[model samples]
Target: MSERKPVVLVTAADLAPEALALLGGYEIVYAGKTPSDDDIVSLCGQHDPAAIIVRYGKVGAAAMAAAPSLRVISKHGSGTDTIDKTAAAARGIAVRAAAGANAAAVAEHALALMLACAKSVPLLDARMRAGHWDKAVHKSLELHGRTVGLVGLGAIGLRFARMADAMGMNVLGFDPYAKELPSFVQRADLDTLWKQADVISLHCPLTEENRNLLDAKTLARCKRGVIVVNTARGGLIDEAALLEAVRGGQVRAAGLDSFAVEPMLAGHPFQKESGFILSPHIGGVTSDAYVNMGLAAARNVRGVIEAR
Candidate 1:
């Protein structure tokens, strides 16, 4: 008789059939809705699965503590902010993410936001739909001669820089960890970049040091009427400060995909702010990207279970 394959628990949303097929022989346990820490603990205790896969939801310490048999944690996406990595590391659980799986999608979304802001696409479309043709008030700016500053030159940032360069925009980047800038991009310190850039885009992760990195003081350094794009984490920019800047005309336009608070509140100032475009954290949410990440997570789970 064949031995039973190790069990695996998936605590994310509905799985695509392709993602499911990657599990092959494993005994799969699906937690359809968002699971609380206590629920996760109970599930792990009952299943004693070889691994647990999670998406945007939090997996707390209690859940990690209860899963004694867990050998790996496969994150469905790149961000591991919701997971307690320290606890998992202490327990000798291998944590893996599909880091580059959605890079291109996110980069393309960032460029789209930048172009929309530069061309005043949202405002023009709204006016046209309202039967008021206000072309003069919504005059678009040319991106060809503008300077773009990238705050973090990671995989997504570099990809965005390439797109911006191809659009005839000059690219400058700032990242303390980066050793060298690509030939097309100029390297600048944060303050210099703020002063010189007509458009500024953020592409950094959320960490204690970078939380609220774009506060009032730093924002004050930016060139007046600067366009801002944030496809990265929301906490990096101060929401209240951004609102103030927009109201005061310090910021000409803003494009944001993520927010300090997920599913931004109904009456948020940005919703009413003119020339601002907001997406519901869809920067890396292309169908192809989703399948790529899901398959990567499934394969990670299989690897852990089959290790000799």
Candidate 2:
């Protein structure tokens, strides 16, 4: 008789077969989109999963408490905002994040957004396609020889800094907890970065202390016509203040991947608003990143499960 495989609950619809195969003897159950807290609690209680893999979904206190067999909570990507770490820790359950698994994909997306905003790609494309040639009035910001300020010095931030340096842009970074930095990247204080950088790219996590780090006052400190880019989290910027700054011409433009509210409505104000380039939080959803994140998540689950 063969030994029974342990049960693992996966909130996402699917993961790559290559990643699932790594678990060997784990019976993975796919539960697509738990819309409510009740559903989350029900699933954890019913499945009694040895491990829980979270992709884009959230796992909270109720879910953690309901599952006595839950040993680990593995995040498919880097951020841990959706998971209740305190609850997991209190129950002696391990919570692991797949940090750096999608660094390249996210860094590239931030760079892409910055370039598009600076060049006014969306605006120009729209105007030209509508049979209105406004080349005479169109102006684009030159990235070469510009100063770029990075808010965080993590894997994604470092990758973006290197890419900017290659394009002859000066890179300045500010991270209070950063230990070391590359020679190509100069260290700067928050205030200095605010006053000097022509482009400010945010790559920090959303914490209580740093929420709305880019508020009206901080935005006021920036040089006129400074471009803002955020691929990290939604709460980092005060959207209302950003819109006002853009309207007043204090800010040149903004590139946003995440929002304070997810799944922005069909007719959201930003859709018709000028000076803002937006995406549906797809900064780290590349095919390569999916594989890396899935495999890393699986490894975290298996490692924790095997420890006992």
How well does each candidate superpose onto the true structure, as a TM-score? 0.92, 0.96
What do the candidate models score in CA lDDT, each in turn?
0.86, 0.90
Lowest lDDT 10-residue stretch of candidate 1: 31-40
lDDT of 1 by residue, 179-277 (tens): 877899999998899899999999887888989988899889999999999998899999999999988988889999989988688998889888589
What's the CA error at residue 107 for candidate 1, in Å? Answer: 0.7
Off by over 4 Å in 1: 1-4, 36-39
lDDT of 2 at 304: 92
Q: What is the per-residue lDDT of model 2 for residues 146-196, given as tens digits with 9 covering 90 to 100?
A: 999999999999999999999899999999888889998999999999999
